[model samples]
Target: MRRLLLLPLALVTLTLMTATTSAAEKDARVYEMRVYYAPPGKLDALNARFKNHTLKMFEKHGLTNVGYFVPVDNKENKLVYFISAPSKAARDKALQAMGGDADWKKAVADSEKDGKLVSKIESRFLTVTEYSPLLKVEKGAEERVFELRTYTATKGNLGHLNDRFKNHTIALFAKHGMTNLIYWNVLAGEKGADDTLIYLLAHKSKEAAAKSFDAFRKDPDWLAARKASEEKGGGSLTAEKNGVVSEFLVPTDYSPLK
Candidate 1:
């Protein structure tokens, strides 16, 4: 299996799910989930079904999606996917609703009109840390976004990543209009809380996103600082375990910034 290396910076065209609630939480969370697949050759039919029938069902149901992610270099052994939800309770509500939605049932039936989508699909939920600031984004944010950057780390490297982020990149991004959130270590995927770091930047639109990176990448002082920290950490900028870079977009149902 080839490693998923490069990060994505495009608008993903998918999102869904909804629920009834009385009070909103103090801090909304960007609940993250990873769905793994069976195998490529065997999954063709299932894949077709998702593109055709199931994707619409999810939209029709109660889950409000932010975006979907495909590992940069997916081979077969391991596969990864992403979704965004407002809160854990909301997520639970959506999942419970799934158990009862007729559209989803029909979508599943029509797709598996042949067979199941996968032999097994496992998923985990995540909470966005308050400090990163992703949950605060309102619906209008889609109109202005920045980068969707992910930093992957192994067991010993999280401390290093944290230091790098706090001391430099975080500030640079903020200065450059890179908003819409912070860092997340894999909390519920394969390695759960031990394998990865994930986060997205919703900048002031794609053009601004391009300019922000250009300025950051071109600054010699910034480059030197990054290099110096890397040396002190005894390695490179990121730990690169499952170094995956993914892309995503907002859906109408759950966007907060409108």
Candidate 2:
């Protein structure tokens, strides 16, 4: 992760900076991150085959998972996995290699030949927006944490999600140690015209993040704020009401998202 602050005057500042910097620096690899939550009832079995057993097989074949995190707030039925890639080209190279790797081929055949653990997995591919920046992460740190969340507002609910977040969620996230990287509203590559909102959260480390979130969750003020919002119009999410289905993303390569 790298650190980038998006200021009110960000456009002016960024344009001036980019104008001054050479082209080579502009192409430095920026990973587009995604996070997904597993559906309920079948997650345990799914993890055995995918996250744990299959992911190890992935690492053997070069698909390195960056990390995993779950939502402290939304805990319906979800487990998250983070994926990484150096560059788009490198991402493709790795996947191509994985496809040809005997281990991956065998694992896929043995595990999924019958059928996938879950009927379908939700996915989102995000691109790093200019206004956002990934903070440089340090290894062997006391804590390493990342929060990958999506906003899936529909034709009407989009405004509410956007405005409410602009008015509240951003500051709340910032106040609670959730730093902004980049956010993608509707990055392409999903199966439909639109159905998801994508963003990333960078933390000092997972340990520090756990503690920070524990504090955030226990705060009386935060609870009250949320309760107050619910009193207004917070029931905007429903499978049929919104007519939206979304897949969270862990950043990967060879994507159509931009």
Per-prediction tally of clashes: 20, 18
Estimated TM-score for each candidate: 0.55, 0.46
RMSD over all Cα atoms, model 1: 10.5
Backbone clash pairs in model 2 (N, Cα, C under 3 Å; residues 3+ apart or in different chains), count: 18
| Model 2 score (lDDT) | 0.48
lDDT of model 1 at residue 146?
A: 28
On residues 22-116, what C-alpha lDDT tens digit does candidate 2 reach at each position? 33234244243433444555555555666445566556655545544444444554555545565556666777887887877776667665455
Candidate maximizing TM-score: 1
Q: Which 10 residues in a row give candidate 1 its minimum summed lDDT?
A: 11-20
Best by lDDT: 1
